[model samples]
Target: MNITINRNSETPIYLQIAGTIKNMIEKNELVKGYKLPGERQLASELGVHRNTVVKAYGELVSEGLLTASRQAPKGYFVQSAVNSWNFNNRFFPLEKMIRYHYNEREKRFQEIFNDSVDKGYISFGGIVMDKKVNPAGDMGSIVKHMLQFDEDGEIMSFYHDDSERLKKNICHILAAENMYVNAKNVQIVAETNQALYYLMTLYLSEGDSVIVEEPIVPDNASIFRNGGLNMVTVPMEADGMDMDKLEMQIKKHKPKFIYTMPNFHNPTGAVMSLSKRERLLEIAQRYGVPIIEEDSQRDFRYTQERLPSLYSLDQYKSVVYVDSFTLTFPYGVKVGYVVGPYDLVDMLGRLITMTETFVSNMGAYMISEYIERGFFAEHTKRLAAYYSQKLDLLCSQLDQIEQKGITYQKPQGGILLWCTLDENINERKLFLAAKEKGVLMMPGFLFYPYGYQGRGHIRLCFSNVSDQEIVDGVRLLGEAIDQVKTKENCDE
Candidate 1:
């Protein structure tokens, strides 16, 4: 066996060796059941450390590309009948890519705060509502009133395909946003996450392809990958997804659908321009691929006129629109709705039935009543204004840090700001250090399907943290980063 290692490459020596062997097996250059050189012999032949050889073999074993037999004096050999089962075929690569980005951080979350039940740490991590901004008093009264009404059998015990009242409320909400659609065209009552899952499962299948923005919401990536579809990521610029690359990918891949969060896009906080929106729809129409327009955070914009949703511009009914009040009203409500072609709605409704029996009828009723009474709108307006103030405060404090190595965009509307640290800093290491300091932030890599692509970036949520905590947390972060850099320089 022959193997080459690149010591100068960023890839570890063990990975280089393991990758070579895996490639050889994949190409049939090394046949099934072929014996690999003994670890000591291979280490000597390759002029590398023995532990490097052991690590390489361990990786192959985990990948199911090789098997070890201690009965035969501890030797490694390629698995017999390797082609009998395609290990890669069962693996969801895209989901793995997305999970790989966040698994470490999530594990760290469990490790650091797993014991603490209270919310004492400065949280720039989770997407949360400002308790002060939400009309919890009014919502509590509504819940109490609904519970009292349960005695009259008017509390919604069953699911209706089209909750007429909820549909009407959704239509009115859309109209306020400058998107006019009849209640008849809207499908009421499913959580936003479930709605997205229904759209993917109903519209796509194994081996099908979909186009999504790079550094997308990790959950969406996981959903698409787990559904056994290929997700091709289009890079984003300050304006939104790179239209040129998007069109190029559309042509190259001929994807079945394109998923986008046009307003205050997740992870990047870049809003799509109206012209770009028009262009995106035109391109989708040209390619004959349906667009899943996620307007989840459109209502959270802090500055500039809110752009019309893609569904607002969809004369051809090619856009499947999904939105929710989870970010604004109540996270526990789990109420979201989708508006699209009637047939598509019916299809998704059937999927909803098969999956969760039905969307929460009682929850739907409460939301509909809240909207009809105008509380939802007023509450959301106030919530947006409050978040805007917090956003301003957060950015102002971050600006005063005067750190030469830190860079971030001041988002106009969304709860999160994506930040890039000095190139020499590692966000994963910084995350660990920040955890020790009781400041929590989401590493930027979690927003993308590719790990390491966002190595120097981290996401901070302003909607949940207090004004004072934001100031103190940023200072602590600066100190932690400086310490990491100094240590890295010393080690080098």
Candidate 2:
């Protein structure tokens, strides 16, 4: 195959090579089963670094446009099936990549749990909060009251808009958190998942773009990618999303929205500083992009002072806020609310109606009663103190592990901590091996839009497991890491 390289062009050398190969495949110059020159030979022919050639090949493989196999020291070759390639017919490339690969990470975690169950090993995977932490008895009383006062057959009726009383209760709750929005400005009830889905569907479309934190909530990115929006990720520092990179991407891409978790961000519990929050709003206003502020974990702050939400700071009403009770109270209470400009809320409500026709009113009523009685606030405070101690205990144990091999950050709040293994370790394999030993954790890759980007990172949840289990789980996980490292070294 003949390929041209343009070192003088602004395009990166590897991308140029990948583009040339892609063009050749499209033009039928590189026929199915065609053999390409070896990496060193390609490097020589193109007058580029060998790593550049290798990177080009890796990109091609990732795009599913090329296949590689080993045949007794054989080199790479074009898949004979390339004749069927149809770029035009392709589902958006990034979306396909995310769906095919991201689910694999989830599957690996699930497999670990299954293996642990079979072997009677105590598994510490999944975001299962402590049962004792849940105010199930209180919630049960609320449910009983709901059934007794079930009037006008509203309880049995399928209604989309939450009961007006519940909306008022939610509004009051937000006000206490420094987010002063009117009940009329908020849409009362959808599952938190659905709330996000409605917002994305209302604002984004095929060929549109969105900016996200690099290692964001995995499912959020997967949904965005699958929706056919190009997702550009900006790396997150301890302070928050790197505002400089965010500004550059916003200027370059002019994305339709920016999805962020400002409070106790998922996977990594880095909280956005107040100054960054103000600047972030300024950038969003300048770029004319709406900010989706997920304050799901607001009630879990371990510190003495509360952080102000973006919605509270938005003088221009450019922030679209979503909050949920799933993590705080009972998981089965599927109630979440979104607050934004009245116009945007109206549009989103219409979208929600079109999809879910409204949220469950009974669930809304029960949650409202829970809040009305002030049980929600008290319970959350208790949970925060409890989890704070657990986090401290877990981090102490994790710190004793050989630090030369592993890295982790202590999260101020939330249930998860992000840990990175040595470059030599493969988290995906470690996740599988850990499961076999009755331990399960979300691999770091599951938090990114591109699953492969976070290859050496894993997320551990300390909220669900007991103090003893935290110690045991970390010990088993440390052992699993050693085994995976040995296996990877042997393969190399």
Candidate 3:
């Protein structure tokens, strides 16, 4: 038996030996029932301690590659190669796996989001609005009222186009935001993201470039990536996506379409100003590029006047608008809709037909009845008030930590707050350390794509936690930051 060891290598001796032996087994040089040299004899030949060889043999034995037997000349021999085969035996390159190839950040993101909290751990991971503010009673009342008109499953008919009544109600909702569109141009989707995915599949072929604003919610870029499209990011300023830098990138890449969330933008909660919206439309129209506007959170605005949607401003029919009430009603209702030019809406209708997937007509009927009868407007008012109070309380709590070198913008309206820490504190280290103290907030790294790191920044969602939990969570978060800072000072 020939075995080589590199003393200068950082890999442990046992690992190196096990790896070499495993490779030999995979290449068939060491078939089943092949005998390994005696630990003492192998150590003598390799000029290493017998214990090192013992540990190596011990690892393989534990892995079921070898079994104790007197059948061999010594005592043990290879047993079953099939039993030793692992998940990596597939030999497929990781880059070819769509679920993980484009980004592993999403897996890490899921880990943080899905962590089961201890009895009292404060979790701020999900973006769902606080249930206390959700219009559960109103929805219950609506559902109870809708059941009266069921007429033996008549509303559940098979030969259906997107509900004409629901589509018109959505049109009226958009009209309130100054975006006037006919019901024929609206395609109801189970969720807003479904609209985005369908649009990406319709417009972007593999390797096509799509312009996106940076520091967005992960789903925004992830859907485009899954469609085999490349993303060109335009940095977001306080007002919105930087138009000057955007024009520069436009000149360079000339992407197929631009995607943005103008009102109460994700993670950052930065609302675009009216002027920025106008300029955004002008630039897209000038370049002959269409825009996909995710207008999901605009209804939750707390401070300023609502901005006109890009779809409303486009006379050239250059924008596709997506909206959902998933926040106001929470995840229970998946009602959302897409509005665009007649042709694009027709294409989406065809795609839905091909997939044989349609939005829940029952969910549509309930939401439509709620909105038409004016329950939704009143429900939103109540939600705005509830979330506004929480927002104020959270800002007050954050103010208490201003002296600790943690500062954040008090979002005008929306559930998330973007915070920046002192240059000395590492946000990544603070995230893990904070979890130990029973408080959770997302590290900003998950929001950015590969090759971009959101250092010294953390995003906290006020949408999900309670008033008391917010205080304790932020206080614990502050303590975590201080612990990091204090340790750094002592090390210095």
Candidate 4:
């Protein structure tokens, strides 16, 4: 097997390998039923990591060009006639497809999740609040009254009155976080991700740079990619993102803005320290760069005192705050808001009006009424207590299996737990095996911008699962992980 690899090329080595193999299969150089070199052997011959070869083979497998053998042969075998479709057809040609740079793997993950749901798999996958803790009984009454009696035409009218009321309610909520802002500085968007999309469209252009954490929120990563922005990622430390490296990257990239989840960050559950937040704001103010702060998971805290948000500490008004009611309320109510300078808020508000005509007006009115009636505070307080018990159950179950090369830090307050696996464990295999055993989980690689580097981690969201399901799911998860480890050891 003589394959040429250019070390200097911009294309990744795994991609280059997959491309070469794909070309060979298309030209019939490797026919159906042919067996390729094993991952370790190919990696040894090519002077690359075994994981790189694994990814190359996985790419072909995903394209239906290869199949794995369970008996006799132990490597991937070529499949029959996989690439029959034409890439340059007359109608709906591939060359003229939409410009959104969505990764095919994300679609694959969604397919897996849907299939798991249909199969009744115990779900530890989605970031949703438990239905048992939902305030539907209270919200139902508010929704019913709004629809029955359109008092002041708040629900039926296209006027901005309902929107204004929602912003005013959001301002009241932010006051608890120590962020003092009026309704004029608030803009209602559909959710946090949409808020980010709007801000990116308004501030950034093609090829403009932005800085974010290495293991960024997956949706935000997709948004940045689709918007044609250059992403500069800084590594995450236990306390938060490494400020020293962040400053260095800022000096180098001069990004349009910095995006951060300062409170209860997604995937990692790391809370940024007060000192780091102050330094971050100071640096951004000095450099004339704005910071986009996402605080979606702040209200789910189980322990520790709540710290002041960057929006509150910013004397120069350099932080644009974004949050949503997805977790605080039920999942379907996708109401979110952005707080910034009045000019920016006004522009975002106008954009929302132009694009959506109205941002969930009925839902907004319901939430505003909920806040005014003191239901919002009552619901959030109950949620913290409810989710605290769930988190404790998950941590205790995980504690029993710590010796199995899995470890995690108990988060001070968040809905998810971030666990680190032993270096030899493969998270993709673990996820597949767990799914096969009627449990679903997220692989850490999905959170990373580049694959293979995040093979040693996994995130489990315990918010939606029941206590019994948590116990059973952890048991199955541990078995699946052991099976993968045993197989890897045998192969070696």
Summarize candidate 1's per-residue lDDT along 184-271 as a digit string, tens digits.
Answer: 6787655677776777666666767899998876666767776777888887888889897787667656688889989888878988
Report every candidate's CA lDDT: 0.73, 0.72, 0.74, 0.78
Model 2 residue runs over 4 Å out of place are: 1-121, 136-140, 149-162, 451-455, 486-492
To one decimal, what is the Cα RMSD in angstroms of model 2 from the true structure? 9.8
- lDDT per residue, candidate 3, 1-492, as tens digits? 756664422245676677677556645679888888888888888777888888888878886777766563666687654432111111111121133244666666666766623335687765755556666446666666555445665544322333788999888887878878899899888888888888877766676678998886776677877777778788788999999878766765667788998887887888888899999888877776778999887777786576677777788778888988788766477888899878888988888888888677777777777787787888888877878888889889989988887888777888778887765666667888898998777877677774332235778877767778988988998898888763232211
Model 4 agreement with the true structure over 1-492: per-residue lDDT tens digits: 667564422246787788678667755789999999999999999888999999999999997789988798677999864323212101110111114756865665565546544428788886656678877447667766676436665555332348898888888888887778999999888889989888887777777778999787676788888888888788788889998778766765667788999877888899999999999988887667788999999898877688889999989877899999988877478889899988888878777777764478777887888899898898888998988898899999998888777899888888888898875577777888998899888877677775433237888988778888999999999998788774232222
Candidate 2 weakest lDDT stretch, 10 residues: 85-94
Winner by TM-score between candidate 2 and candidate 1 = 2
TM-score of 2: 0.76
Collision pairs in model 3: none
Of models 2 and 3, which has the larger TM-score? 2
Off by over 4 Å in 4: 1-98, 112-119, 149-161, 452-455, 486-492
Q: After superposition, how far is residue 31 of candidate 3 from its true place, in Å?
A: 61
Model 4 clashing residue pairs (backbone): none
Lowest summed lDDT across 10 adjacent residues in model 3 is found at: 85-94
Off by over 4 Å in 1: 1-118, 149-162, 402-404, 452-455, 486-492
Q: What lDDT score goes with residue 326 in model 3? A: 83
